[model samples]
Target: MKIRCLIIDDETLAHDVIESYIKEFPLIELVRKCNNAIEALEALQQEGNIQLLFLDIKMPGLSGINLLKSLPKAPDIIFTTAYPQHAVEGFELNAVDYLLKPFSFERFLLAVNKVRHKIELESRSAAAQGYFTVKADKRIHKLNFEDVTYMNSIGDYLKIFLKNGKVIITGETLKSIEESLPSNLFLRIHKSYIVAVSSILYIEGNQLVIAGASLPIGLKYKDQVIDRFA
Candidate 1:
């Protein structure tokens, strides 16, 4: 499967450099080259199914960050810019990687390789049914199905507790994470909590004990929770 790429930069030289570098990797196919954000948007709509974007930050009209913000569903981005300050903002947007100007082909290959690995993992994950990947601490964290004891919602993040006394704090939402896990092996026993079916030690009134920790079973969820045990 080729990684269809789009180059959006005000500099023709930057486009040329990227195009030349990408030629070394036969798996990458250049889809289109656009001058500005608007052109990029147009190309995206017209081209459709672009998997990778090489976006430039300082263009004539809209900035790369702003352009990335505007897309409802964006492709994997590798920010190719002269400015180093926007690197933080780019990562916050979940870009695959950031490349400063005058970057080597080795560096370029490194970023694209990350995207390739990510794509392959996603494909494999969809087919296999054992673990799920979560992004945390500026890296991808893989959580095995049997290891996770429970998950608790902490503000905008989740505190995932494992059976081995490890806790992973991540930005993944409870609802989203719940949907990702196998329904047969996990249960949402509360609005803010999800527990592994095999981890529950016993039910104690409105709460269930799992791995020596007490987790509440919401009033609304009690019936279904009891039915699961029944």
Candidate 2:
């Protein structure tokens, strides 16, 4: 499938440069070019099903982040910016890449290749029957139906708290981790946590102590949580 892409840069030269660069590959199709994020927003509405966006962080009406925020469903964004300060913000939003203004085609290709690799993984994940792999700093952590203890959300990462006190930080969100973990072993007791029924030490009122950490038991999950241990 062709990856439909949109470029939202304030500079005509940058647009032309990207247009030239994309010509090397037949998989990427430039859908539209916008002067700023405002124009890009309107174009996204018209294009409907775009896969990638080459966004400039500093624009006239709406910044790249502001544009992404306004959209109900935003496509993957690769920030094309002159400033180096937005790198932290970009990763926080899970941006695919961050391209400096004077970047070369080689650099741009590297970023695009990363996006392509991500798309391939996402495609595989969609057809994935049940299992999913989580990555920590050094290990390719596997979450088999049996090995899972539970997961807890801490910012963007999830803490896979096991029964034996081994904890792993996965680069996935709470929602993704919940879907991949076995429902019987892992129960989401709060918006921020999912715990193993076997590992739960005890419950007091709305407080749940697991592995010596006090996690609040959300009112909605309280009954199911108690029933899990019962």
Candidate 3:
């Protein structure tokens, strides 16, 4: 599979270096290059198929870290920066690898390999057991898709309600989690809620009942929700 990649960095030299290194990997496709966060954000919004991102932490405006925060669903990221001080924060944001500027081609290869391995493992796990993994409460949890009753969004975090009457709260955006879910089994019925299609009991006026809880359907999503059951 070709992994579509976008490079967001201010330095022309950084872009050149990365593009050169990417040529060695037949599976990595360089789709776009942006000099600043604003342009990168536009590209991200316009392109839905980007699988990986090469981002720089320090930029003239709208620092890379802030750009990452703004994205509702970010691609697998590998931070390419000159600053070592931001390493901790980069990893905290779930960066696949933090490559210090002037990194050798070998180092770049290692980071890209990690992304390949991660995608492969997730694909295998999802196909084999219908499970998805998330990090929450300082732990990584492997959860069965069928056990998820519904998910509620609370700012930058999500409260995932389960069939076993338990909730898992994680620092993940609703849009991000929705992208990872199986579209056939889950439906985003509102801006703040995503329900397991099978868990939905019935539809009331502008609302749906799932696991005995009533959740309102956003006006923008009402038509899609109705069509789901129609």
Candidate 4:
């Protein structure tokens, strides 16, 4: 899969150089190039499938580092900047690599190679994994997809209910868990709840009955839920 990329920098020269380097690889697709973080934000809002970002730390207005922090689910980042001092901060933000300004095309390739490996690993894991792992009570827990009855969001974590009346509370967002689940087997009936399509016993109005628990279907999701189970 071609990695969809966005380049955010203030320098025209930087944009040209990065674009040139990216063009050498058929696996990289440069989606948009922005002169500042604000434009990058606009681009991100408009396009949800952007998988990678080439960001410059010291932009004119909102800095690239701040923009990354603000995103709810930021994509993989490679920080390209003149200031080597920002390397620590960039890595702290989980950037795949830091490219110093005046970097060689060879250096750019090395950085992107890391991104490609990361993408490959994520794709492999998502496609092959049958269970989700979580850290709870100072220990690791694995919840198999087949055992999951429903999932509910509780503040920063998710409360996952099992078919055998077991509950596992973990620091996982509903959105993240939903993305990991098989879409054919799980139906997101509400913003806060995702129920196993097979475990659903009945639907009472806008609520779904699963494993003897009633979960409300959000108004925005009601129609889709009904259509799926109808």
Residue range 10-73, candidate 3, lDDT tens digits: 9999999999999988768787899999999887765434679999988999999999988876
Query: What is each predicted model's overall lDDT from 0 to 1?
Result: 0.85, 0.76, 0.85, 0.83
The TM-score of predicted model 3 comes to 0.58
What's each prediction's TM-score? 0.56, 0.55, 0.58, 0.59
lDDT per residue for candidate 2 within 58-164, as digits (tens), equals 88878888888787767778999899998999888889999998889999999888888887676566435445688899788765544445677788887886556
Write model 1 residue lDDT over 1-230, tens digit each, in one string. 56768999999899999999988987787878999999999887655346799999999989999999998778899999999999999999999999999999999999999999887776466437789888789988999988999999878999999989988999987766764665567777787898988999999899999877899998756766777787
Instruction: Score candidate 3 by lDDT.
Output: 0.85
RMSD of each: 14.9, 15.0, 10.0, 8.9
Error of 3 at 90 (Å): 0.6
Q: Mind giving the per-residue lDDT tens digits that candidate 4 earns over 1-230? A: 46778999999999999999998986787878999989998988654356799999998879988999999888899999999998998999899999999999899999999999987777667646778777778888888877888888878888988888878888967766665665556777777888888898899987788767889988756755776756
Tell me the lDDT of candidate 2: 0.76
Worst 10 residues of 3 by lDDT: 120-129
- Pairs in clash, predicted candidate 3: none
Model 3 spans > 4 angstroms off: 129-178, 181-230
Sort every candidate by TM-score, greatest first.
4, 3, 1, 2
